[model samples]
Target: MAQQFEDKFRRKFYYLRLSVTDVCNFKCTYCLPDGYKPSGSKNSSFLTLPEIHRVVNAFADCGTSKIRITGGEPTLRKDFTDIIRVIADNSNIQKIATTTNGYRMERGVAEWKEAGLTHINVSVDSLDPRMFHQITGENRFHQVMSGIDRAFEVGYKQVKVNVVLMKDRNHHELPLFLNWIKHRPIQLRFIELMQTGEMDDLFTKHHISGVTIRNQLIANGWILKVRENNDGPAQVFVHPDYQGEIGLIMPYEKNFCDSCNRLRVSALGKLHLCLFGEQGIELRDLMQEDAQEAELISRIQMQLQNKSVSHFLQEGNTGMTPHLASIGG
Candidate 1:
């Protein structure tokens, strides 16, 4: 089943972003649908744990050395810890991380650590309770804050706080959010909300550029000294004398597709070439066929061959659906 395939840049993609579920407990305003209702459909329960392992192992055997677990909220999955352990135990994967909403970390951090989760990224838009509630559409501010504190106490070396920069929504809180890392061990990342998912219509409405953000930070005397991560995205820097670092994930403003080396797997097992991909190869179908490692590797190689260099961020683009939550943002 191993078909010959490769991309233009000669960069062998070996990273897989796997979404565990499309079930999140909280309805964040930016993420939830217009008339939202929680529906963990039998078809939408996402891949079974066994199915997930099969897919991950297939990638690992194909030279995938890094993996990140994401979801509507990956922690919500009952077997999340077990899944983490399985990926961690895989000798081919060097790093294992999860992106979460932070509401559950308070009660699950220790157990998650025991399960071999090495790094964590928490979505924290604002520190103010009222604004936090407005942005996330949930009154779990206290719980989220407590969870983040618990993450620090649990001994996670790289606990990154990801703040999606929304134009007029939480834009004013940037300085305050930056202050959270003044003397803390946690890293902070300011992300430009992409024009994708259900929020695609709001592209022109809420799109905030990275240049504006950098200028604002400089205006407030937050000097940025560039720091680089050879294996990861995000152009990072440190505020002078700051404890950790500040990372700017300017996917819209700056294109890093030339050196891109990652592919995303939807909760349903589709292999997306880019975050804004219109379609993906059905890995679940391949798995159901009882394909061997070499065969699976060939499918991945074929998927990567179709990987485009950059994504179109134009307004009203119906490039993809299932939202960022469904696809593991």
Candidate 2:
């Protein structure tokens, strides 16, 4: 294997989050409240299939074992299944995953699994259909729930559900979420609402710390699971009485970035060293041809060295990120 992808702090990266597009159908209140407006760029500007193949190949060669395809909603891309196949073709890659809105899972998950998708995460911010509709600006709550059931029927052992916890929004439904996952094999992840350049007021109004939930879990006998090298930033907890698990993503917590082990690449082929980094390094030029693999890998490694020890979220520095969907947060 090539040299492991490590930053200056010696955090070896084993996972890659690759965005295929920035277009999303749901007008999530925290993400895109007014709905998705096209950036006026041509759709053809997004990374092509061959470009994706080359990028994945380079990462896999550098000892990256997992790839998570993310997006405003990754399923928006017509060639999403082919994207999975491209990553799966890399023998060095041990896991192929995607984070989706579950709108198409009911109809497309079976084929997606056949195409070698090993893991799936669906965003279900609220359990109450009315509240879900209110938060997501869509009335497809039942449709998304049915899609989750279909995913299980199609043979996914466990599906992760992401809830962006907001004050006075879905925060009161924590008990409901816990009970819903009690008998199911779902890992309910409660992500603390983050601030972005465009959503300052929303962030101030809704942002609640994940520490409160963490304390509740500890007092209730939920055991913290030791993280694997390639795991995402969620602090996974399990209970002996329940079949499901809980994961908390608290970006504002102290030492949160000490275990950073992943990197992101935008749909437009810019490498993001940190989700809140100042800028993305352009990798599209090198990705145009297969012969540029060596230079591509070198550029990635060189950029890794400049990665900061931690993000500046606590200091209110969101960097160039106007919103989470832009970098597949």
Candidate 3:
């Protein structure tokens, strides 16, 4: 039996968000408003495939069953499918997922599915093409929509669409999103805009509480779904009249970290205990050899002891995270 990855608060982690790279194509207003700028280095400093395999193996040994491959845009990597295959080879990993921008889904999703990708979460901040273009600085709104359709055609039972709910941006389009998902098996997630080191001004101007939407869903007869062990921090709700579901991710909400089950690893191989926590613990050196699995797991467990009971977002503390893309938020 695998060992449980439990923190001091007895929060057992079953999910791992592993970032392969920080190179994104989309220039979202909230995340990469200035677009992705590579560090002044010719060589890509992202973790290698062997390093990723070792990290996943160590996590799997500690009972991590779900691994979400994240990035500034994960699909941009040429070896993305190979990365999926590597994780899928491990019997202990039951689910292999990715959170993407959906730019390559139309052309590359079939190959990704064949490589054993089980779940996909695509960021679609706005349904309006013009608004989408304005928000992301990309004119590929229709292309992304078509990619989602292709995802369904290639055998995805359901797709999760992420929308960062900003006050004056796409908040008024809630009804449109509800209608779109009424006939589709989409889990539309509305994430509250979070305060990051670089986007404090934007967060102040556009941040909206997800409680407004959550209360609306409850009043409209949407029932809350019981969360699974490996589920992320989304509070999902379902309605009898609609085929789709709705999820709310409000990090600023009280006790948000009580059910914490996921940890993040940056592309540089540092383990992050909390998204809004301090600088992460380095794990790359231990990943150099397969024989270091035991030590790797030990270091991970040791770091968990330092994870606080909750994030200090209420205290206006965003920690060391400069931007969401920096650590694959």
- Which candidate has the top score in lDDT? 3
The parts of candidate 2 lying over 4 Å away from their true place are 42-44
TM-score for all models, in order of appearance: 0.89, 0.98, 0.98
The positional error of residue 195 in candidate 2, measured at the CA in angstroms, is 0.5
Q: In candidate 3, what are the lDDT values of residues 101-156, reduced to their tens digit? A: 99999999999999999999999999999999999999999999999999999999
The C-alpha lDDT values of all candidates are 0.75, 0.93, 0.94
Q: Which stretches of candidate 3 lie over 4 Å from their true place?
A: 40-44
Worst 10 residues of 3 by lDDT: 38-47
Q: For residues 1-329, write the lDDT of model 1, one tens digit per residue.
A: 22223476676666778988767776776676442454555655578777777888777776677788998888878899999998987787787888898988999999989988888888888888988887777788889889988988888766898888888888788667667777887778888877665675666687788778777666766665553222456766666667777777787654556656777888888888877776667777666544555666677776576666677564345477656776776
- Lowest lDDT sum, 10 consecutive residues, model 1, at 223-232
* Better model by TM-score: candidate 1 vs candidate 2: 2
lDDT of 3 at 240: 98
**lDDT (C-alpha) at residue 164 in model 2:** 98
- Report the Cα lDDT for residue 183, model 1: 80
Model 3 has an lDDT value of 0.94
